[model samples]
Target: MLAANAEEAEKFRKETEAGDYDLLEGEIWWRDRHQMLIDHGYQLRPRLRPGWEPSWNNSNKNPLYCEDAHVGLRLAGGGTIDAVRIMDGKDVGIRPIKRVSSERTIFKNLADAQHLTGQDQHIAHILDTFEDDRDPDLVFVVIPLMIPVWFIASSLKTISGIVDLFKQLLEGLSFIHSKNVAHRGLWSYIMLDAPSMFPRGFHPSDYFQDHSGVHQIKVLPPCKASGPVRYYFADFRHSIDVGQDAKHLIFGYEHPVGADFDAPEWTAIGTYDPFRADVFIIGKIFNEKFISKYENIDFLSSLVEAMTAKKPEARPTAADALKRLQTITSTQSFFTLRHQLVEKDSKEPESLLSENINILLDVAFHGLKIALKMPSRTISLVRRMKRGSKEKETAK
Candidate 1:
C-alpha cells in the first residue's frame, strides 16, 4: 500500500504477479498481527518482511520460528550488556559469529532474532554482554527472544530456504555496518535461533525410568522436526572483553576471533583497527554463505581473503560482501540437495558475444533512458524549490 505514484503501484503489482500474493496469515490482537506460538510482540512474518495479514487470524501456530527471553543491563557509559549460559558441549571449536560489534548499517533489531537458534529455523542471534570503562559491570542492552515449544529442528530440505535464512544474517550484518557499529559477537547461536524447550542434559525427557538408557525415548531437540537447527549467541556479558574502547575479539561464528576475522592492516594494530576488523569478518560470512563447505579449505580461503588484504581499507565491508553474495546466488552455480552445481564455461566466445550484445541492447533501450531522465528530474526538483522560495520572498 506504500506507493509514491501509479508507477510504484504498478511495480508492486508486478512484483507480486510473479508469485500469487497471499495475504500473510497470522492472528490479530489489539489490531496487531501475531503468529501462532509467536510472541504477541511480533508484527510481521516470522522472516521479518513487511506485508499485511488477511484477517489477522492464521493458525495459532505456524511451526516455523521461535523466540528467547531478554537479557542484560545498562552501564554508566551508555552501553548495555548481558550474559548467556553456554552449554559445555554441542560447540567447542565454533568461533563467535562476527568481529567488532556494530548496529547502524549491517546489524538489525530482531524482535525475536535471538531465539531462532538450535531449532527448526536455521539462524543464530547476537545476544549477551561485555565490559566497558563506562560501566562498573557488563551492560545488558538487548531483549532476548522466546522460542516456541514447536518450530524446532527444521529439516535441511532445500538449500534455498537455508540460504534465504542465512542471507538475512548478512542483512543484519549489513545493517550493522551502515550504522558504523561492530558485530563483535557473531556465531551459530547468535546467527541462528535457539529453542527454549530443549531437554536439558541435567533434565532428561523420560516417559519412564531409563536405568539402561533404553526407555521409549524421543530425542527431539527443543525444536520440532521441520527444519534445520537454529543457534543463538548467549553471554554478551563477556561479548566485549577486547571490543569497544579496547577492541577485544568477541567470539562465536569465526574460528579465531581477532587474528582470523581481522583484516591485513589489523594484523599489527587490530586492537585499534575496528572498522577493517569488522569488514574482514564479514568476508568470512560471505564466502560461507555463497560457497558450500568442503574441507578446511573454505575456512582457510576465508581467512586468506579476510586477512590477505594489504590494508583494512582494501578489505570488503559487510554491505560489499552482501553484494558479492547477491551476485553469487543469482549467477554462480552451487550444489544443493536437488540441483547439480557447476560453473559453465564463460569462454564460449559465441555465447559470450551474444550475451554481451543482449545486455548492451537492454541497457541502451531501458537503462540509458532512465539514467538520462534522472538529471532532468533533479533539475525540476530544484526549479520547484526556487519558485516556492521566490514566492515566499515576494510576500515578505
Candidate 2:
C-alpha cells in the first residue's frame, strides 16, 4: 500500500508539471472503468465519464465557479468513491478491498447480527458487494452515503443534539462489544444518517452544495424537529471479532497503529485489550470534537475523563458509559436540555444572546407543533422529562 501511494504521488507530480490535470492520477481507475461501474448499477458523476469534456474548458468563467471543476473532490482514502445507485438514485459509497482482508468477513457478521438480533442499529450496513472483473482478487463494498458526524454536530444548537449523538455512539460501541468485536479505531469512522436534515441530499464531496454539486444545499429543520437522527459506525478495517474470547489481547496491527487518531495505549509494543482501547478511542473522539470545544457541556467532563483514563482497566465499558449518560441526562429539565451550548472560544457575548433567542423560538415552534398534533421529538423528550420529574417527586 505504501509503494502504491508513493507511485500515485509521483504520477500526481508529473501531471502537475505537465499542466494536464483533466483527471487526477489516483482517479484514473474510476474514469477508466466508468462504463463497467454503470453496468453494475452505479453511476459515476459526469466528470468521471469516458470521453467527457469539461464545460468550463475554453469558457470565460473560472473553473472553480463551475460544478464540473469539482471532479477532483475525493475522500481522504484513495480507493473509495461516491456514486449514485442506478436503481434507487440514492447516493452510495464504493470502496475496494482485497479478497484476503478481514473487512468482508466483519461486514458479513454485522449483517447477520443486524438481521437476527436487530442490535446493529448504530453500525453502518453494507449495501452490496461485487467482484472487480479486472482483478479477481479485488472486490468493491457498497455502503450508504452518510455525512460526517462532526458536520452534523456543528449544525446542532442545543444540548439535546449532543446528548442524542453520544447516546448513539455509546449504544453502538456497546452493541459491537456485546458481539465480542473490538473496533480498535473509532474516530473518523463515526457517521450520521441525516438524509432528512437535507431535503435535496448533499454532495458527497462538497457538502455545502446539493447532489449535483451546483446549488447550495437546502436544510429542512433542526435535529430536534427532524425526527430521530441515526448515527452509525463505519470502516471496520481495523476491527476484530474475538468471538467468545472476550479476554483476548492484541499484539499490534500490520497497518498503522490507529485510525486517524492514536489512542494512548496503542504504543504498538505490547499486547493490550482492544475492547478497552475502543472505549478510549470513543472518549478521545467525543472530547476532541465536543467537550474541548463547547463550554456549556461540562456535565460530560467526569464521564469523558473516566473513559479516557490511562489505565485500560479503569475506563468504563461502553454499556456503563451509556447508562451513566442516561442517568446524567435524565436529571436535567427540558429547558436545561434545550439550553444552547456556547463555544468555549466564543468571546462575543452577543452570540450567547442570539443563541438564547433561537432556543426560545425553537421551543415556541415545538410547543405549537405539539398543540397541532404534528411530529416533534422535542415534545416526546419533554414528556419523558416531566414523567421523570414526577417520579422523583413521588420518591421524595
Candidate 3:
C-alpha cells in the first residue's frame, strides 16, 4: 500500500511539472507576500495564493481553454496589483512604493488637507497605507480601483457629457494647484470612477473581460442611466509641492518623457515651470482625445489653443483656465449642449451606421419630449433655446 501511494504522488508531481502552474519571475514577489497581504485584510486571486494547483491538471481538457488559466496575470507596471477587501468585498488597488517617496508623502498630505473642498477636489483618495512585513523600505498603499477616463469618455454621445468630463478634470487640476502642488506627470494618470458602468465588475488583468475572464463586460454608457461619473487625478509619482510663492522651476529628467514631451519647454535649455507644463499636457490630452476627433466642441478651440501655446509662459493658470471654461460653457445653448457630437471621420462603415442611428434616435427622443411638454427639464431647455436665439439676434 505504501509503494502504491508513493507511485501516485510521483505521477502527480510529474504532471504538475509538465503543466504551467509555476509563478513567473515577475509574479513571484506577490506570491511570496500573499499571506502577509491576507493578514492585512486583503486577498489576492486564487492563483497567487500559496499551494495553488491547476484545476485542469487531471482533466483531459487543455488548460488554455479553462476559465482560470489567466486569473492572476501581472500588470505592465511591476509595483501595482488589484486586490479584494476581505471585510466588505470591495475592489481596491495596491501598490508597493518606497516608504520615503514623494508619491507617498503627497498622498499623505492630500489625505490630511483641510482646505480642499469635496466639490472641486478630484484627486484619488487613499484608503489605507501600511509597511510591508519583510521589507522596511517598501510600503503598500490602498486606493479605489478605477479604469482610464478615456474608457468612459470615448463612448459619450453628447457635447454635455464631454463638457462635464472636462469640467471635473480642470477643477481637479485647479484644486491641486490651490494646494501649491504641480502634477509633473499629467495626462496618463487621470482615471475615471464609475462603478455603476460595470455592474458585473471586470477582470483585473483584462479590463474588457468579465471577472471570470469568460465573457466581454457590458460597458454602460456614461449617461443619466449609469449615474454621474467623476474624473480623478491619480499616480502622483512625479508630483512636487512648489511652495506658496510659486517660483520654483523643476529640472529633473535630462530628456523629455511622459504625455507632454511635445511641450516646447520639456526639451528647452534649462529648468521650466511644472505648472505651465501641466497646462500644456492637459491641452494635448484634450485635443488628442476630443477636439481633434470630434467635429463639434468648437467652443473649446480657443481654450485648447491657448493651453497648448508654443511658449509655456503664454498658457493660462489652472484657475484662469477653469474660469475660462466655465464662461464659455455658460454661453452655450441647451440645444448645443445636448446635440449629438459628430465625429470628424467615420471611415468604418459599421461605425458610421451606428453613429448616424444613435444621432437619429437622440433627436427623435428629445423632439418627442419637447412636443409632449414634459415637465421642468423640457421647459427649461425650451427657455434656454429662446434665450440663445434672442442673444444671437442682438449680436447681429
Candidate 4:
C-alpha cells in the first residue's frame, strides 16, 4: 500500500546502484522458493528504471511484462509471461512468459484480499506478484524487465502479418480463457509489461492508482491471424472480474473475432463469456484481413454480412472463421485467370512504365489464371497479345 512516484522511484534506482538492491542471482537465488527452479541458461532481473514508460502511451511503471528472467524484451503494461526454459540450437533459451491462470487456485486466493480486490485488475496471473521497493515499505514488481508487442506492432504489413502480431496477446488471453478467467478490461494497453519492478505485476510508480472508480475493456479486435499489426487493450487498474465466461459490455471491444464472438444478451453485462468475446475479436481480425479493407470489396461485404448477424446464436466461432478464411488461400500459384482485378488507383505512375511491361504481363496473366481457376488463360493471353500488335506497340 505504499505510494510510489517518480521521486521515490529515482531514489530507489540510485540505491540499487549504491549496492542496496539485490539482483537475485547465483547460488542463493530468490526471496521466494519457487525461483529455485530456474537455472543454467536461466537468469533473473529485478525492477529497473530509465526503461521509460511514456505518460500518454504507457502510463504505468508496472505493466506486468517485467519478469524474473533476463529475456530482454519489455512492454508498457498488463501483459503476460511465464517461466521454464526451452532448448535452442546448441543453447537453451528462456521461454517467453505466459499466464498462470488468474482464475486458478494460487492467484484467486490473492484476489480475496481487500486492498487489491476492487482496483480493476485485468492481468492473467502472477508467477509471484507482490509489492516491494529498494527501501522498506516501498511497492513495486520485483522481476526482470520485459517489453510488449502491442507497443510496437504498427510497422508490419499484409493481413497475415498483422494477424500474427497478436501472438503474445492471444497466448495471454487464451491461457486465461482456458482457466475460465475473464479479463474484464481488455483495453488498448493491457499488454504492457512491468513499469518499474517493485510490485512485480503492478508497480506503484508505473501508473496512477485509481482511488476514483474507473471502467474499461482491454484490447478488442482479437487476433485473426499471426502478424505484426497489433491492437493495444486496456488500463489494468480498472479491470473487473464479473464471472466465468460472463458476457460484459465494453465499448470499442466489439470488433468481430471468429464467428462465436457473441453475448447471450447484447449489452456488455453479466452474460460475458470470454470464449465468445475472444472469438468475436478474432472475427474482427478477419474483417481487416480478407474482407473489409484490402483489395476485394465483394468478398469483404459477404464476410461482414455473416459476422454482423443480429442474433448471438447466429455468429460463427473461431473454428468457423478459420474455415471461412480457407477460401482465401495462403498460396495462389496456379499462374493461369483473366484480368481478375484492375488497378486504376495505383499511386506509382512508374508501374505504367514500358520497361516493366513484360514482367507485369507475366504476373498479371498468372494471377488471372489463379483467380479464374483456369489453366488456359496463359495461352489465351499470349494469343491476345499476338493479335493486338498495334496495342502492344502503343503500350511500349
Number of the predicted model whose TM-score against the real structure is largest: 2
Q: Compared with the true structure, what per-residue lDDT tens digits does model 1 show for residues 1-396?
A: 135565755654554444333322221121121221123122222222334432212222211111110011121223221112333212111112223353211223332432433332222343333222223432223334423212222432233434454455556555544443454554332433433223321111121212122233233432123334443323232122222444434323332344423434433632344545655554554354434332212322543374336665566666665666566566433322222112233245675466455445544565555556578779799899999999999999
Give the clash count for model 4.
Answer: 99
Whole-model lDDT, model 4: 0.36
lDDT to native, each model? 0.36, 0.77, 0.75, 0.36
C-alpha root-mean-square deviation, each candidate: 20.4, 8.8, 8.7, 16.8
Model 3, span 1-396: residue lDDT tens: 121455665665565677655666656678888989999999987777788777656544444434555745555355578889999998899988889987788867875562345443787877888899999998998888887765566667778888888788788788778788888665557887888778777777677777666577767766534455878887888788878765768763532355543567777778888888878888888898899989889899899999999888899988899999999999998656866677886557776667566656666687675567568887899899999999999999
Poorest 10 consecutive residues of model 1 by lDDT?
Answer: 63-72
Steric clash pairs (candidate 2): none
Ranking by TM-score: 2, 3, 4, 1
lDDT of 2 by residue, 10-93 (tens): 664454346564677756788877877888999988877888776644333444445665755463455578889999898898
Q: For candidate 4, lDDT tens digit of each residue in 1-396?
A: 121686755654454446443332321222232343232332222332213222222232322223221222222232322232323212111221223332233234433331254532334323233332222432222222233433323323223333333333454444444344444332243443322221222212222221111211122122211222222332233233445534543454433333232333335443434455554554454455434444423433454455445455566543454445445333322221111222325435564353245335656665564556655777699779887997878899
Clashing pairs counted in every model:
97, 0, 0, 99
Ranked by lDDT, the better of candidates 2 and 3 is: 2
- Ten contiguous residues minimizing lDDT sum, candidate 3: 252-261
TM-score of every model? 0.34, 0.83, 0.80, 0.35
The superposed Cα distance between candidate 4 and the true structure at residue 289, in angstroms, equals: 9.0
- Give stretches of model 4 more than 4 Å off: 1-153, 166-176, 183-272, 285-292, 296-308, 323-327, 330-347, 350-396
